[model samples]
Target: MDRRHKPSNILPPGEKLPAATVDIDEKRQTVSATLPNGDTVEVLLYGATVTSWKNGGGKTENVWVSEKAIWDGSKPVRGGIPIVFPNFGPPIKDHATSALPQHGFARNVRWEFLGSEKSESGTSSVKLDFGLYSSALPAKFREAWPLDFGLVYSVTLSEEGLRTIMTVRNEGSSAFEFQFLLHTYLRVNDISQTTINGLGSETYIDKVLNATKHEQTTPSLSITGEVDRAYIGVKQDTTSVLEGGSPRFDVIRDNLSDTVVWNPWIEKAKGMGDFAPQDGYKNMLCVEVGAIDGWQKLEGGDAWEGGQLIKSLL
Candidate 1:
């Protein structure tokens, strides 16, 4: 860890945070950090505002982060975790105009490293939590769709991979609507070589059109072009597996009933300048776990939470 970085034992006992921490390789414009177990996760803060998590051998690195989710951010630069909120797709002028920071501000603003700890399964991990509220927003946000809300984003760095959990709590009156997703960009050895399993019998929502319908009646997806679609009304008894075989990863989400699988492929990648190595499609895939379709309406006293646990069986 850098001598200048703040040191904190954010994890539970038995698991110590690596003294080696996150630092901006200014010359490279990349943020790199070594975990307590001697592993590393890097973030290329160009268009993708959040960290680009990479393991030792470098499997999957480019994934989206969605909290209060949206796709609008500093254009040309789009990757990382975009906290989409209040609503998902195109901005609805009346309902969720305030959610228009484009992907929300979670990605744009930096997060605080709280601590590290061992989850129930006893894996060593670092827990980073970020919160956003109306009180934290500017006057402009307060003028838009006004609501008292707080988002708790916890990113856990485990030996296997990163486990992210987001808790959305409504802090104000008047039931409001919103959406949530963990737009994870997974690294792969070859796109053509990968075939995600476990979604064989599930249905998915197609985002290419406004018609809220699912196309996975057959329950299987093979990526072709820009794979931008949402899978909804899923049962908790489902398992989503992502792999090209040998180096495989299975994602299990508790309390989340939706999944989004995406990849910009060649054309979309070329359009984004920050996404250098545009040909990197062969190495990444975006499988987002989310709550889309109808906006989730939460009363002031209610709370909504979901999580993604990625385990690698290499």
Candidate 2:
């Protein structure tokens, strides 16, 4: 029996229960949802980045945000789940996204709030939709990419987990290639006590080791130092993050074939200006799910979709 589907106590006569609520803060450009059970999720319009998710009656924070994250849209939010689209990492020379900045411009621009609704799944869930079109891009980015595209990002929060889906529509007359990643920063008590279960038999590109290809021999991986590896061709659809030998988060993917595990450790943590408290790396680990090992080509007038569901196992 799924815990989320368990029957609730019957309401007394003439008594009403609180319903889920969604709030939009126009001044801050943020949207937030709160469940009757006290779980909450918040998103920033800038990049449609999810800044916080608190479950367990608002006592536990599953998502992590940098203390120094710029909230005024001066820079990309340093943590939470930032969308990486069009390209991943540094752009390749001669590529269509070559002129775009690292991780593309999706995280640097503001997205329009499409709307919110109660999920049709018969579960107590709230869904928020955001859209970003090529025309909405700044002139500099529009000129750099020069492709007509539309992206619809949907974030749904329920007792099951936080599910995010991105649908890309190529509105132009020609096919275009792009890479996408959901950069999720998950909170943890300690880095040394955390382990990632899955991708044991997959090959990974160790970005910290000059992009060397290596086979993952351990069934469970731990981050000891500055770790940055992209596990390619992941055979499992679900990966679990364990803390102190207990399951903490389960990342379920759809159409996402790769997983990137990263932690800046010491030196790299101190290097980033946005990463505050210097040692904040010990409290956060990035288990990014995406289809970025290679490009996904979308034909004109066609749409492609991919996403991940981050379930809090706590």
Candidate 3:
């Protein structure tokens, strides 16, 4: 069984909320970080998954974690930023696929809370780090994927929005390859009314149509049904403004090379146990930033860093 917050966990000295005395709530093993101006960001200890990111002086939320999202440490949280490492999806071959879990095991394990510090952004913000290393893994987990690695992830919460930065370091004697993604789920009033900009004219592999090559014609993408497309080699940064809502998601990627736009419509939602309220599809959109089409080959002792910053326009 997993350990809950104890006296030794050493909680942070966080800002106060409107009525509550404490802003950092670890009651449910979740850390509620607040900016000096009242912006709040909640992260779960299970996956270091940021469940909610609300801007200051506004009730509107940017990050969307499913209402039915699992919190028992049994599986990955349904929404928010599910960090995809080592593997993006299932492997093609039979035997090779059994070695790793879908989207990798990083999201399913407990990350060490490295405490918080005043962010360097010069705003009313705080940044915290969570890390995972092969030395901290259980013996059984190590037997599955023997690569020795370390991952350090940081979340910076500001009145403007939330920014996540990840750095992966190779600790072993041999070179290793890995893929990465910040599987971000943004909340929207209605999916059909949301127009995703920046990748409209790009090239993509449509997973909904069996990975067929496609060239997006328009400058903004509108979703009507089940859609899953992997757009690789994205050249420009994007500010995806969900016009129906004012929370413009300005996704800036550095060293991150791909984008995955997906929405599991009605039918698929019903089939998923993690995503309940079948109609919930209309309220969420996953615009993930990743290096999916290719892998990052890191030599021993080499480290790679990449991240995405989601800032609100409104």
Candidate 4:
């Protein structure tokens, strides 16, 4: 940990504070942020993937990290919030594309820890900053893309909710286009009882239905089968509630124009090698906040920022 990046609030033994702490986890490479208000968030240095967010106020866990998730630093973690950058899936045009790998390397590559900070309004918040630069990337990776860029990822935790923001700057003289998404796997007691609201008449491209465009029929979404849709033009904020469990989650976001609602039902769950429990699909839902179905173009010296905040609702 960098000495200059120390947290602001320090509490003694037996004392409690509305402060935040940034520490390397017992696992060695992971980082954790625990707020004084019972809000906690955890992330791995590899992929900068957020693996946990437990609400202390309700003593409830909101994130659904896969038990069989790979932690050997070989592949992207199966659950939690995986940052998708440069490309949402595979590269569309090989060398012309972002040299994509599934969801780009943002969630599969190692990141540099810049530091941590704490802030307060009526409520307190803690934030950790990470950086990913083209210079730090592998030689072949740069050779393939040859575009210089920098990414600053901020994960903030507060009594209100958890927010993860990604800011990408064009360090090179040329322009680049990329697709992004926060592959958030939310924990739920039962998928059948979970319903995501706020996309009533929005248009979505159903990947399972031959990529056709259609407006949402219902105001509330109930997942029963495999769902792979990119809801474009989400002009307003969203609210997803889990009625099957106590301390329901309110997933919120801003400046994210797309909502990817997905669930790999029984058959799809059993086919995934990284997802554990085989039937774990029934316990989770992915209401991903994203800028998918379109590309964000950034010219030289330009930047783009977007984030989502998640909190528990009792």
The lDDT values for all models are 0.59, 0.90, 0.78, 0.79
Per-residue CA lDDT of model 4 for 45-106, tens digit only, reads: 88898888888653777878888998767899999898998788677764445455678778
Provide the global lDDT of candidate 3 against the true structure.
Answer: 0.78
* Cα lDDT of model 3 by residue, 92-125, tens digit: 4443224787887778887888878664333356
Instruction: For each candidate, give its TM-score against the true structure.
Output: 0.75, 0.94, 0.88, 0.90
lDDT, candidate 2, 1-314, per-residue tens: 22222223222244344557999999989999998888999999999999999999878999889999999987899999999999999999999999999999999999999998764334567888999999989999999999999999989888878888899999999999999999999999999999999878889999999999999998999989999999998988888999999999999887779999999999998889999879999999999999898799999999988888889988
User: How high a TM-score does candidate 1 get?
Assistant: 0.75
Candidate whose lDDT is highest: 2
Best candidate per TM-score, number?
Answer: 2
Model 4 residue 90 CA deviation in Å: 2.2
RMSD of 3: 6.9
Give the range of the ten consecutive residues with the poorest summed lDDT in model 3.
1-10
Per-prediction tally of clashes: 29, 0, 0, 0
Residue-level lDDT for 158 in candidate 1:
62
Off by over 4 Å in 2: 1-18
- The 10-residue segment of model 1 with minimum total lDDT is 1-10
Candidate 1 segments exceeding 4 Å error: 1-33, 42-50, 56-77, 98-105, 110-123, 209-214, 217-219, 236-242
Clashing pairs for model 3 are: none
